[model samples]
Target: MSKPRKPKGRPVSGWLVLDKPFDFGSTEAVSKVKWLYKAQKAGHAGTLDPLASGMLPIALGDATKTVPYVMDGRKIYEFTVAWGEERNTDDLEGEPTQTSDKRPAEEDIRALLPKYTGVIEQVPPQFSAIKIAGERAYDMAREGETVEIPAREVEIHRLTLLKAETDQAHFEVECGKGTYVRSLARDMGRDLGCFGHIAGLRRTLVAPFGEERLVPLEKLVALEEIEDVEERLAALDAFLIPPVEALTSLPHVRISDDQVRRLRAGNPVILRGRDAPLPTPEAYATSISGELVAIGAVEEGEFRPKRVFG
Candidate 1:
């Protein structure tokens, strides 16, 4: 008997969900996979801290153009926050800044969790990617700069306290984009009369991608699996939004070979009969037939292409 031979690589462009390994930066992992797949382009849907692992969506080739779609997708995470202790960075990577001999009962954690749900204000950790004064916040923090970052609004759609250990509280959170789990743990501590830091963090889902669909790094790095690897890529139309999202008055244009050419050249051709959903905050190109050609940003009533693909 012979093992099933995998395909060489995906012919069409798209995304793949990865179960990221701990201790690896998103850029490092992306670089490795992008090279292995020989993809002309690649990027992740969202970022996960090096200590945090799970569901990292990697876009390939043309699919890279749809990154914004995935970036805006909600994320789900399961984490273990060690309570009664505080860290400078709010995670295992930071040094302990404080600790408490007191412990919060499981019931206490449960009762306190509801206060974080829904829209809330949160201050991002000083050691974060957020930009401050034209430099990365983390950079300033590392250089020993002390600056107070104002609290901003972030939505925590669902935050459930799943369990409580002697020194840790396990939780699952489904939150809107930009919600910082690091800050969540820190603030949660202040709310509970103690300090806390993330002991373990894992992302279970990023909107369309779930844990079940995730492939681990070890499996992906197997050179033996190269054959048929292309089949793993998501379809080109995977980024397609509902027709209701189309622009009014751009009524479907069945792109001819010529139109495809012009659009490929970066021209915003006219669509007859108009009638697309109001241009979204960021515009996207749709064919006369309504297939997404590229994402566009609307300016002065015209949609200009941003990221385009064949």
Candidate 2:
């Protein structure tokens, strides 16, 4: 019999909240983080365009299992909309497809906020990651093929205009998953009779992670200068937040050591006591010592393991 190939790199696990710099692609950022950490596996919670800068939560090793939880969380973005021209891609990266000389007044912009604040249908930018007929939309867009992209509902929790200028406007938005800020600028421009595109965009928050947890790429790169390999790895490891941090929005249960062993072995552990939680579709279990053990479901007073952590 042939031997199984072992995975390379350390089995390090945790979340690295990177303050991605402008012009950096999300996939590229993940590669860099994985290489720096020398981890066996790594993945990012959400995709951020090259022109966009901000919080890009990266998961390494076993933490990759919790990425879906973080990606589903609310996001906050601060962006600047440059009026007078609208681009094909809906951002500054694309060629101008439409132009208008009219500038919207501050009152006019404020009046338009209410319309976009609630759940509304939005057409994603043509140059986006959305797939069409099994091909990426951005790839088709780059080939000069314009396809009819359907509009879908996206919830905007809050949209606030912070400043307005003669040719540009700055705003901050808190929105749900899959909401595109680029589309916001494009649609608002068309409504106000002034063409617009995103000139600057920065993500400030992603659910459980906030600006406080963000570590700039440069700061992490600097740790590479440490003389000893072990010390350098330790320094890099210091920035990793616990994997449980990403599951803050989900129901959590602390189990006994015996329960932890059962859960890790892919067995259900009965919940005992009057205060036991009711049935839930999803929840995470931790050891009595507070270490993440497994993500599972609670049903009929039993915690059934779905994804056990190593």
Candidate 3:
């Protein structure tokens, strides 16, 4: 009888969500996973601070192309602010800038939370990745220079005070990309007629992925013992949506073998099968089987593929 053959490890393509471990920098986490998997290429969609732990998506192989879409998704966080205090780093990591002799009441803080809803001005903490003079703002701060990071507009979709105490209040917020929680806490203190700083911060979700899907560092570290690692990967379609077409406006067009060849060759095709108004610039192009094949737009009577995936 022939001996049974052991399964050979194969290359993979997908996104992996790791519940980032506290104290592990985003770069370190990526490196660890890359080394463990012996993957040739890996990258993260968005970076989470070493101090902040939560949903972090790591893209493997061809899935790296979808990272930008994933990173642009809405983000949600649960954090706490220490009223009557301000910090340089805006979080517990920095030295106190100022401390108030009094704390704001819970109701007062709750009332002010709504003020942050919608658009707002946010001056990112000097100790941040923001760039100034071609160097990182945080690096300038570390060199003992007072870096002035200009205020930029960021939107806050929702801000709710989850709980409150005398000196601190818990909060849950849903905000757009680039909105900083540390900056919000700092500003919240100022709103309360006192200084404030972020104390406890946790990112619960980066839309499409939630806390329920996060795998903590402890669990990730133990993954070495587990045989299957595919559970953490996000499907390719998770961030992609098929193009919208109305039956009244246009019907599904089947791409013939010749057209498929043309599409593969990056040729512009006059889709006669397009019975209705083809697709808008935002429409997703897919195969006849409904598999996302490319994103394209109609121009000069030809459908040009903005992005193609065979």
Candidate 4:
């Protein structure tokens, strides 16, 4: 009998901004893009719901090392909420659990926005990916168990009401990590006296990437059908955002070749300049050649490598 063959894929690296399609799960979206690039490693910055679509940053190989930074970045979402009914899952995919005959006026909806804006406590939906007893909260909810998740503080920088109708409302939100739009919509409905659930959800921006950088799945699918591997790969490479680009928001210090060598070897090097502004404890250190050397912390005027790129 022949031995089982292992799959062949490239050791490709960098990030792909995927315009995830509606009804497609984040994991499946990552898998499809990984296969398209034939990457040895892959991961995503944020989990976009299957019912939601837009900006899902897929990181391959070395880029996966910086996913934490991307996830910590602020995100912008534009969603529509359907009024008069509340769903078990807090989204349109769930069964209706309650209904109301009231619809808040435009002025009333505007008044409610301020309460949700700024720093506030939010309880995630019962059908969320949050962990409960080492199992997913959604799994417990699907099994018909009541899951009570604790309310946690989240920053909502902006909450603008884009439009309003008797049965539906559109809004845009810019928030920090851990903010759930579903929860926001659900609570808004409750506060307004008309039950609501997220009817449509789309993430428009995740720091370091925005709508302009998003490449649709259809484009990658087209590349996959090409017979020539080199040609296909070259074409696909055009979509790659350099791995180091993920650290753009961080303060960067240029290092000499010797310092680069020291960083790659996991050593700390003293930085000079009495007049220069002090770097943040955590900052990106790059080579004079514009290549990322390491993500390091400044301690006593020394750049100490925390994670080296090589």
Candidate 5:
């Protein structure tokens, strides 16, 4: 008997902002999406813990180049802190290492908000993906190794006490890259004298994409179940957000076809447009038809191609 043919994956390119479900790791989520789309290449902007559920932006093909932009973008998360217990992982996933009977009042919780706001020094959780001397901290931690994580500066644009119950408190934080909500909860508990760990977490927004564009895993799985490959591919494309959308944060300049060809050929070209004399150091160069040609820097009014895209 002849063996069935393996799928010759499609050259899919675009972004899929997945509403990652609880108990699913970011890598698993990416693999599921990539299989559903039958994409040749795939990657995720950032990771969401298996205990956390929220936006996990998966990039395919050319979109992978913009993963850094989305990862560096401001992020918004709503998480719940379960007061009275501290765990090894700083979240409910680990065993309880410490406990407290004290719980702070609403006003007490509110008063502490200011201290967590703005730039703050935070030590990442030992059970984190952070690399320590070429080894993953979490891997080392699980093997019973002592992990000493140094505190690093992280920006917290906003940290508010949304609601406080007797045993749990909800919070919403808008922060820059490197801020760990787990660490935030740990420190908050320490300050409140109650001890706490994250009970739940959800990411609502990652710049250029949010809840509005989030596609749940179930929908992608449904598409994957379809028997016809062509029909499946067509249906999946309907949900793709153009990879170029990731470049939305950067300045953009529309260039003529001749300039597009030159830029794609790795040549610098002088641009003529309203946003000319390119104020931003780097900008997305689009063609007359709005197709992305290259990512380049503005030098004396000339757009020098640094990374050209087809």
Candidate 6:
């Protein structure tokens, strides 16, 4: 019989809320973190553009399993919309596709805010990750192909105008997943009789993770200078937030050792006691010692394991 191939690197597990710097791509950030930690597995909850800087939640090892939860959470962004010119990419990176001499007044921009709030249809930018016929939109855009992109619904929980300049306006927004700030800038300019594109963008929060948890990329790089290998790795590991932290939004239950064993074995465990939680669509079980055991559903007084964790 052939032997099973063992995975490489350390089995480090946790979430690293990275304060990603401008011009740093999300995939690049994940690769940098993985190389620094030498972890066996790593993934990010969401993609942050190279032009944007802010909270990027990265999962190491077992924490990768919980990425979908973080991705589904709301996001908050502070952005600058520069008027008078709209680019194809919807940001400064692309050439201007349309231009106008007019700039919107503060009162006019404020009046436009309500129109963008709540559930509204939005069209993504040409230079977006959205796929068309199994190919990336950005790929087609780079090759000079202009394809008709469809509009879809996105929720903008709140949109606030912070400051307005002669040719630019600063704003903050809290929105649901898949919402595009660049498109907001583009559409708003069109409605205001001025063309616009994103001049700057910085994410302040991703639901469940805020600026408080952000660890700068520079800090992690500094630790690499430690003389001893173990000490360097320990310094890096200290920045990791527990994987359970990512599951705070979900219903949770602490189980006995017996229940933990059964959950790890992919078996259902019966709920006990008067305080046991009511049936839930999704919940997570932790060992008596407070370590995550599995993500499961509680139905008919029993917890059925879905994804077990070590």
Greater TM-score among 2 and 6 belongs to 2
Clashing pairs in 3: 85-195
* lDDT winner between candidates 4 and 5: 4
Task: State which candidate has the highest TM-score.
Answer: 2
**Model 5 alpha-carbon miss at residue 15, Å:** 0.6
Q: What 10-residue stretch in candidate 5 is worst by lDDT? A: 271-280
Question: Residue 248, candidate 1: how far off, in angstroms?
Answer: 18
Better of 1 and 4 by TM-score: 4
Cα deviation at 61, candidate 3, in Å, is: 1.6
Candidate 4 structure quality by residue, lDDT tens digits, 194-260: 9999999999999978889999999989887889999999999899998888998877888899989
Work out the TM-score per prediction. 0.78, 0.99, 0.81, 0.95, 0.95, 0.98
Among all windows of 10 consecutive residues in model 1, the one with the lowest summed lDDT is 240-249
Mark the regions of model 5 whose C-alpha exceeds 4 Å error after superposition. Answer: 1-8
Model 2 segments beyond 4 Å from truth? none
RMSD to true structure for each model, in Å: 7.7, 0.6, 7.1, 2.8, 3.6, 0.8
Number of the predicted model whose lDDT against the real structure is largest: 2
Q: Report the lDDT tens digits of candidate 6 across residue range 1-310.
A: 9999899999999999999999999999999999999999999998999999999999999999999999999999999999999999999899999999998999999999999999999999999999999999999999999967899999999999999999999999999999999999999999999989999999999988988999999999999789899999999999999888888899988899988888999999999998788999899999878899999899999999999999
Q: Write the per-residue lDDT of candidate 5 for residues 149-205, one digit (tens) a residue.
A: 889999999998888899999999999998899999999999999999999999999
Supply the TM-score for candidate 3: 0.81
Superpose all Cα atoms of candidate 1 onto the true structure and report the RMSD in Å to 1 decimal.
7.7
Q: Count the backbone clashes (under 3 Å) in each candidate.
A: 19, 0, 1, 0, 0, 0
1-310 per-residue lDDT for model 1 (tens digits) = 9999764544345666778999999998888877666666678878889999998888776676667667777889999998888998999999888888887888888888888999998899988988887888899999989757889998899999888888888899999989999999998887788789999999998876656777788876665354554444332223322322323323332444555667778876554445543444465565566565766655444455666666
- By lDDT, the better pick of 3 and 6 is 6
lDDT of 2 by residue, 1-310 (tens): 9999899999999999999999999999999999999999999999999999999999999999999999999999999999999999999889999999899999999999999998999999999999999999999999999977899999999999999999999999999999999999999999999889999999999999989999999999999889898999999999999998899887888899988888988999999887677899899999878899999999988999999897
lDDT of each candidate versus the true structure:
0.75, 0.95, 0.72, 0.92, 0.90, 0.94
